[model samples]
Target: MEPDFPLRKIIHVDMDAFYASVEQLDNPDLRGKPIAVGGSSQRGVVSAASYEARKFGVRSAMSSVIAKRNCPELIFVKANFERYKEISKAIRQIFYDYTDLVEPLSLDEAYLDVTINKKGNPSATLVAQEIRQRIFDELQLTASAGISINKFIAKVASDYNKPNGQKTVNPEEVIQFLEDLEIRKFYGVGKVTAEKMYKLGIFTGRDLKTKSLEFLDQKFGKSGNHYYHVVRGIHTSEVKPHRIPKSVGAERTFSENLSSEIFMLERLEHIAQELERRLKKSKIAGKTITLKIKYSDFSLQTRSKTLPYFISDKDLILETAKNLLYQNSLENSVRLLGISLANLNTERKETINGEKEVSVQLKFDF
Candidate 1:
């Protein structure tokens, strides 16, 4: 670890229960209540749940029925993909105003490399605070921000104070903060892996860091390298700007496992809607629609269908996705379902008769 290396300023911005929050924001009557954004139909799953609902064990991806069971008073609102996309665009515009080095992780989350910002601000913390305030004042939404010397730490810091909060991890505090963190809180450590780590007596960053590199590599394969570095607060990934999106997708994990096709289709429709909104906002279309299924065992599979022409229409995308899901037999109860648009239409902008035009062409890399 190069403890004396020059630091890079990074900020991670995430919206608070994005979909549900947006719903509440649009209807003040729903504010401060246990709310979820998604359908309440038999097959419906949550896209997002408000903090109020979270207190009742409601969470994103949980089945609507289970969410309602967890919180009997839970309010379910149909997701509005178009509206969410509009707000996402506004938020991205604000990020660009500060720095062009913006990398969006999703509609509601992004990383801004403010090492050399356009505003010439020296403190990333101040910039993060200002951005959060602007989002609240202009959009009537709450956002959480984390500032640190690198992307990994910044992302961790942001979640430290969620829902209209900001947290900063200065260079001097990075090591100590990471050392004391629970291993489960690390970015890629999911529930199953966290349990395995606990069984192995590796409960915290410090505990994991104490193991030899070879031992960790033997245990977790390629991801061991990531755990090794992140535990020591060392990460070298760069924030790529305006990188062409390789795939656009949305997914929901259910609280209770689902086995019925009707329920699964309902959840797929919601994800399809989200994918369409993203495709339109990015001004990009796709030739392939992929359906992802996660079984109750946590095993996952993806099935894809490629169309003859680029498409961004909601109905077309959903139809193709439904076909793909049917073609791939569901062998087990599903815990999560996702839809993705891939093999994007890559065409450079051109002017035809003084008007901007788009031409479709295929390019493949092996």
Candidate 2:
């Protein structure tokens, strides 16, 4: 652990194949069978896959066509978001028993700051273990956890032994664990970023550490700073209970491809209306409005404009989206239309000084 960064006990709890597992848990016949939680249509995408489906290379975000090609017998099940939310609420209640500092990344995953917990537990590792056990015992669902000194490390460690397991990165082993970790395994390093790192001869954290801050900045811009610090075990981000969303968006994938600009305008109006409703529900507005287009061929494009003043009205959002839709000629027939608002009113625009030396012990009783 870096001396400059504050130490805190963080645990990242991630449900194991959440959606697919839920489907299996509710239906006895679906258990141990290869199932995908999504439509098995050409236009549909797989939202999740059970462990049985994963063995055949079926995964979330994969096209249903491709997933079927991978596994001929893969069963496709429609997603039940309402039921999933019901289970998620129950799971969160279990977290509230241990700590108040719970940051939900999504319905299936969250970060918990349990440095000072209700149970008066000194070991974060044991706390995570108990949480996982409670989830299985009460909900009949499995979850994985990562216990570590910071949220970033804990998030990555949580995936180390996934699908109903947990891993803890002790303070003394943080440096070595990161050094040996593959670049692709680092949190926030997606396939494209991993490819970029590989091209720079940075296949591992040890390789990333060899580059100076200036060099990484030149290569990756603002994200380079994040990479440089995280590689050295210096992520200082706290586990905020009320996580502010960076953007609010709504998109619709049409049942059939739409070609006419007039038709798209109608869809954009509907999308903007939905966006406005979401923004209003959250009591948020944004200065930036972006229109996302997904073509019939599955190609994607986005156009954005930033306004001087925030707006959450449906008419305003529709007006901006309509303008952006007309800003450029369509490359192909559009299949999906989306509107997103960024530079939100809820964002905390404060900066944290990274150089401040905070001396806190990384190793607790664990």
Candidate 3:
């Protein structure tokens, strides 16, 4: 194993059930109670679940029906993204106070490069504590922080403790910490990858370290290289403050699954129009249009086509989406339909109301 990497300080900050926490903070009645933020309708999906709800096996991305079955008393509250966006901006400002090298992963989490911070603190541990403390004092919110030499380890460390806590792994302790970690706990190693590793008897970081780079590359392509380096504490990814979004999309789940061809076409038209608005609002034109369909039985399929030129017009989006839909036969009733625009042309800028919008800082959900 190579241990020649430079020692850089990185911190990952993650909010504690951010959406649910905000709901609880605004309403005194919800404190210490099991609550969820999102719809409870049959077609609704849970966006965030409080720690109490988590104990009942209620999780984000789960169908509302399933969440209710898991926790009969779970209180479902609607999500307020506008409010969440305000808090996220506040939290990001706090990160910027310490370092400009902050990379936000989502509305509730970010990674900050703090090797030499604005406060001149040499200890990343102290910086992390101060950030968490400031968040609580200023926002009345609890956050967990992970401190390590890179983004991967720092992110993992942040999850080591719950609601309000911090964990720091020193350079000397990095290897040992990763070695004892489970393969499933590794970033980017989802269920499918974990199952593959399990079949190869690689259950832990130690087991993963037993394989050579060439062997891993042959088995898992580029991802095998990522796993190989991270297991040995060699993640060199920097904390980028300005990361461009690769795609923009919007989708809706229906209260009633649609089976009729005409009904599906109507839904696609709505989805395409919404997608066009999103692309225009973001000042991005995409060459690739993708249509996603989720069947009532939970099966999912997607069809995409690359256009000759970038387009963000409603008519073009609708026409392309209609063509894609007609080209493929519907296998079953669809529960949800979505349209996305990818292969974005970031170099282009648009002038709306005399102001030039150059880049899109993504903060939309549909």
Candidate 4:
């Protein structure tokens, strides 16, 4: 195995139950009760669930109907993305005060490259504590931080102590820490990969390390090398601060799977409307329209088409999605439907005669 890579301090900060916590913080009655933030209908899904709700097997992305069935007393609340975005901006400002090398994974989680911070603090653990404390002091919300030599390890460590806590794995401990971790705990090992690993008798990092690179490559393809290297404390992915999203999409999972082609158009229209809202909000358009379907049996498929011009119109998106949906016969009762736009035309803000202009609205390149 390769020797441990050069030391670089990275910190991963994640807010615990951000949306549900915000609801509890804003409303007095929800403080200590199980709550879910999302639509509470036959077709609605949970965007986030509080820890209390989780005890009854409630989880984000779960059908609201099932969540209610799991916890009869679970309270449902609407998601307030606008308020969440405001708080997210405030938290990002705090991150900026430390370093410009901050990569936000979402509204609630980010990774920071703190090898050389503005505070001139040598210890990453101390820096994480100070950041967490400041977030609570200013925003009235708690965050957990994980400090380690790289982003991968830091991300995993941050989850070690959740809900307003911090954990640090120094350079010397990186190897042992990884060796003792379960295969399921690895960052990229999802349900499918874990099952594949189990079939190969690889249940832990130590088991993974025992396999030869050639064998792993045959078993898991490109990800085989990724697993081998990361187990030996060798993840080289840098903290990317200005990463742009490649595509924008939304999907809805229903309480009951849909089988009829006639009833599918209504769901497709709803998803198209959401895609339109997102496209406009992001100030971008795309030429490619893609449709994703997840079958009741847990299989998935996608079909896409590229248009002659970029579009953000709901009618056009709905028609395109409708075409993709009907292009093939219904494979199975579909549990989820998703629509997305790719090959984006994201505009940049520019100053024109002292007035900022959106490049797309002018219909010309600068």
What are the C-alpha RMSDs, in order, of all predicted structures?
A: 10.7, 2.0, 8.6, 10.4
Regions of model 4 farther than 4 Å from truth: 1-6, 41-43, 252-263, 266-270, 280-288, 294-301, 304-320, 331-336, 342-366
lDDT per residue as tens, model 2, 22-81:
999999899999999986756677899999999999999787888999999999998999
TM-scores of the candidates are 0.75, 0.95, 0.90, 0.84
lDDT value, residue 352 of candidate 2: 41
lDDT of 1: 0.83
Better of 2 and 4 by lDDT: 2
In TM-score terms, candidate 2 sits at 0.95
lDDT of 2: 0.90
Candidate whose lDDT is highest:
2
Better model by TM-score: candidate 3 vs candidate 4: 3
Per-residue lDDT over 1-366 for candidate 1, one digit per residue giving the tens place of the 0 to 100 score:
234333688999999999888888889999999998985845566889999999999988786778888899998898899999999999999999999999898899999999889999888898999999899899998999989877888888889888789898877677788879998888779999999899889999989978766788899987776777777766767676765677888888786799998998888888888888888888989898888898977677989888999999989988988888889678899988888888888644432111111121212110
Candidates 1 and 3, the one with greater TM-score: 3
The lDDT values for all models are 0.83, 0.90, 0.86, 0.85
In model 3, what lDDT does residue 180 have?
Answer: 99
- Cα-based lDDT at residue 72, candidate 3: 89
Q: After superposition, how far is residue 51 of candidate 1 from its true place, in Å?
A: 1.7
Q: Pick the candidate with the highest TM-score.
A: 2
